[model samples]
Target: MSQEVRGVIARGKGAPVEVATIVVPDPGPGEAVVRVQACGVCHTDLHYREGGINDDFPFLLGHEAAGIVEQVGAGVTDVEPGDFVVLNWRAVCGNCRACRRGKPWYCFATHNAAQKMTLTDGTELSPALGIGAFVEKTLVHAGQCTKVDPAARPAAVGLLGCGVMAGLGAAVNTGGVTRGDSVAVIGCGGVGDGAVAGAALAGATTIIAVDTDPRKLEWAKGFGATHTVNARETDPVEAIRELTGGHGADVVIEAVGRPETWQQAFYARDLAGTVVLVGVPTPEMKMPDLPLLDVFGRGGALKSSWYGDCLPSRDFPMLTSLYLQGRLDLDAFVSEEIGLDQVEDAFGKMHHGDVLRSVVIF
Candidate 1:
C-alpha cells in the first residue's frame, strides 16, 4: 500500500516549490520508512528549486533531517522502529572499491530506496540528495539512517545530516586541524562556522573567521572563533597572516565556493599548511587563472571535501553525544523553527542571511 503525504516539491526550473500530495510507498527490502521529526532548510534545497542541481523537475526538496524509524523492511536490522536517526545522503555500499579499501567516506556506490516516491498522477519525483525529508514521512535505505541519542533536539542535531557535518569534517577530517594550530575559515556561514567550531574543538590556538557581514562574524565567535576579520574592511589574507605571527594559518577552509574565496584560502595558508575546499561550486563558474608554478611551489595539500570526507556512522553519533554533553553547541545552528509550508519564505530569509537554519518541525 502507498501512503499519501504532504511534501514540498519543485515543479520546474526556477519555480517556487509547492506542497503537494506525494505517494510514499512502503519500505521494501533493505529500506526503512522514517517519520520525519525535523528537516533543515539548506542552500542545496534552494539550488534544486532553482534548477541549479539538475533538470530533475518536481524534486522532493529537503535532505538534512532527523527522524524516527517508523518501519523497517526485511534485512534492515541496523535501525528499527522507534530508533532516532539522522538521515544521511551517503549510504555506503560495502562492496564498492572505496569501501573495500576502508575509505567508505568516498564510497562511489551509495544506496537509496529502490522504490520511487511520486505525485498523485504517478509522476516520478527525484528526491534531493537521494533522501528527501521535507514531508511527514520519507523512505530511504537502512544504511542512510545513523542512529543517535534520542535526548538531543531534532531541529538542532538534524543539521548533522549535511551542511554542519560538511563544515566540521572539512576542518577535522580533511584539513587535519590539530592542537595549537592556527586556522582561518572564509565566509562565516553555516559551513564556515562549523569549521570554526571544529577547529576550536580540535584545540586550534587561534581561529580566525573571515566574512563581509559583521553579524555573521559575530555569530562565528559563538562557534569559538578567536578573531573575526571583516573582509569588507581589510584584505583577509594579510589580516590572517598578521594574526598568525606573520606566518599564515596552518589550515584555511574555503566555504564560499567561489574562485575569489578559493584564491584567498590558497594565499592565507602557511607554506606547508593544508587548504580544504568544502563549498559547492556551480558549473558555470571556472577556476581563476593562476601561475602553474604556485601549485608546485606551495608544497601543501589542496583537497576538496565531499560531504567533509565524513563517514556518517562514525561522526554523527559522536557529534550528537558531544551536543548532549554540552560540548558541541549544535543548537546554535537552528535560527528558527518553521512549518513545511513556510519553506519558500525561509528560502528568502536564507538568501538575505537572516537565519543560519530554518528547520521544519513536524
Candidate 2:
C-alpha cells in the first residue's frame, strides 16, 4: 500500500523548501521502506534547493539519515523490519566494472528504489542523493540500509550517511592517511572536521585544519586537529607547509570545492603526497590554470572522491561502533535538533556557518 507522509521538498530553483505530503509506496523487489528517526541538514540539501545539483525541480531533500526498517520487499534478506540502519546513497551493484575489479567503493552503478515517491497530485519527486529521507517514512533500495548498533544515537550517527562519511573517507580511503603522516584538511566544516577526526583515528602525527572561519577552526580542534590555520589571515598552503616542517603535508584533503581551495590543496601537499577533493563544486565552476609540467612535477595522486569512496556496508557499521564506543565524537557534529518544518531555517543557519549540522528528529 502507498502511504502519505510529511516531507520537505524543493519546488523550484532558489525556492524555499516546503513541507509537503509525499506519497511513499510499499517496497518493491530489492527495496525497503524506512521509518526515518533522524535526518541531518546537510549543505547538499541547500544545494538542491538552489538548483545547484540539477534541473530536477521539486526535489525531495535530506539524505543524511538514520532510521528503522519498517518493511522489506521480496529478495531483500540484507535487512528486515525493526533493524536500525543508517541510510546510504551508494547501494553498490556487485557486477559493475569497478565492483568486478573488487573496488565496490567506486561502483559506477548504485541502486535506488525502483518506484518514485510522488506528491498528492501525482507529480514525481526526485529524491536527493537517491534517498529522500526527510520524510517520516521513505522508500529505498534494501542495500541502502546498513544496519548498525541500535544503541547509537540516530541524530549523531546518521551523519555518516553523507558529509561526515565523505570527509572521513577522503582522508582514510582516498588520501591513505596513516600513522605519523602529516595531514592538512582545507575547509573546517562538518566534512573537514570528519577528515580531522579520521586523520586522528588513522594516527596521523600532525593534523592541520585550515579554514577562514575562526569558529570552525575551533570546532576542528575538537575533532583532533593538532594545529589550526586561519586561511583568511594567512596563505593556507604556506601555513600548512610551515606547520609540516616546511615540507608540506603528506596528504592534503580539500573539502571546499572552490578553485582557489583546490589550488591551495595542490600546493599544500609534499612531493608525491596525495590530494583528495571531496567537496562538491557548482556546475559553473572551473579549475584555474596550472602548468602541465607542474602536475607532472608534483608526482602525487590527484583523486576526486565521490561520496568519500565509502562502502556503506563496511564503513557505516564500523564507524557507528566507534561512535558508540566514544572513540568517534559523532555527537559533536550535531549543533541543533530541529523538527521537519524548521528545515528552511536550518538552511539559513547552515548558510551563515552557525552550525555544523542541524538534525531533524522525528
Candidate 3:
C-alpha cells in the first residue's frame, strides 16, 4: 500500500525546503519501509537544498536517522518488522570488486531501493543520499537498515547513521588513533567533536580540539578533548607543534573541508603521523601549494575518509552497545529536539554554529 507522509523536500536550488506530503510506497524487493522515530538535520541536507550535490530537485531531505522496521520486502533477511534500526546510506554490495578484495568498506557498489518514491503531485523524489528519513515513514533497501541495541535513544543513536559515525571512523578507523597517541582535530563541529570523542575513546592521551568558535570548543571538551586550540587567537599549526613538544600530534583529523584547514592538518602532524581528511570540500576549492619534498619527508599516510570508512553492519551495532554502556556520549551530540516544522529554523541555527544537531522527532 502507498502511504502519504509529511516530509521535508528541497524543490529547487537555493530555495527553502518545504514541508509536503510525500507518497511513500510499500517496500519493493530488497527494500524495507521504516517508521522513522527520529532524524538529524545535517549539512548534507542543506547541501541538497542548495543543489550542491546534484540537481535532484524535490529531494526528500534528512538521512541521519533511526527508526523501526515496519515491513520488509521479498528476500530481506537482515531485518524484520518491529526491529529497531539506524538508517545508513552505504548498503555495501558483497560482490563489488572492493568487497571481493576483502575491504568491503571500499565497496564499489552500494544499494538503494529500486523503486521510486514521489511527492503528492506524483513528482519523483530523490531521497537524500538514497535514504531519506525526515518523513514519518520511508522506504529504503534492507541493507540500509542496520539493526542495533533497542535500548539506545532513537535521536541520539541515530546520529551514528552519518556525521557522528564519519567523525568517529575518521579517527579510529581512518586515522588509526591509538592509546597514548597525541591527536588533533580541526573544526569542532558535530563531526569534529565526534572525532575528538573517538580519539579519547581509543585512549589518545592528548586530544586537541581546534576551532574558532569558543562554544564549539567547549562542546568538544565535553566530548573528551584534553586541549582546546582557538584557531582565531593563535596559529594552530605552530600551537599544535608546541603542544606536542615541537613535533606535532601523532594523528591530525581535518573535519573542516576547507583548503586552509587541510593545510593545517598537513603541517600539524608528527614526522610520520597520519592525516585524515574527512571534510567535504566544494568543487571550486583547489588544493594549496606545499613543498613536494615535505610530502615525501612525511613518511605516513594522508588519506581521505569517505563516511569515516564505515561498515554499517559492524560499526552501528558496536557504537550502539557502547552508547548503552555509557561509554560513548551520544546524548551530548543532540543540542535540541524539535518537531518537523522547526527544520528551517534548525538550519538557521546550524548555519550560525549555535547548535550541534537539532534532531527531528516523530
Model 1, span 1-362: residue lDDT tens: 88999999999988888999999999999999999999999999988988888997889999999999999999988999999999999999999999999899999999999999999999999999999899999999999999999998999989999989999999999999999999999988889989999999999999999999998999999999999999999999999999998989999999999999999999999998999999889879888787889988988999999898999999999999999999999999999999999999999999998888999999
Q: Please, what is the TM-score per model? A: 0.99, 0.99, 0.99
Lowest lDDT 10-mer window, candidate 2? Answer: 283-292
For model 2, the stretches where C-alpha displacement exceeds 4 angstroms are none
lDDT of 2 by residue, 34-85 (tens): 9999999999999999989888988999999999999999999989999999
In candidate 1, list every pair of residues with a backbone clash: none
Name model 1 segments beyond 4 Å from true: none
Off by over 4 Å in 3: none
Q: Compute the lDDT for candidate 3.
A: 0.94
RMSD of each: 0.7, 0.7, 0.7
lDDT values of the candidates? 0.94, 0.95, 0.94
Q: How many residue pairs clash in each candidate?
A: 0, 0, 0
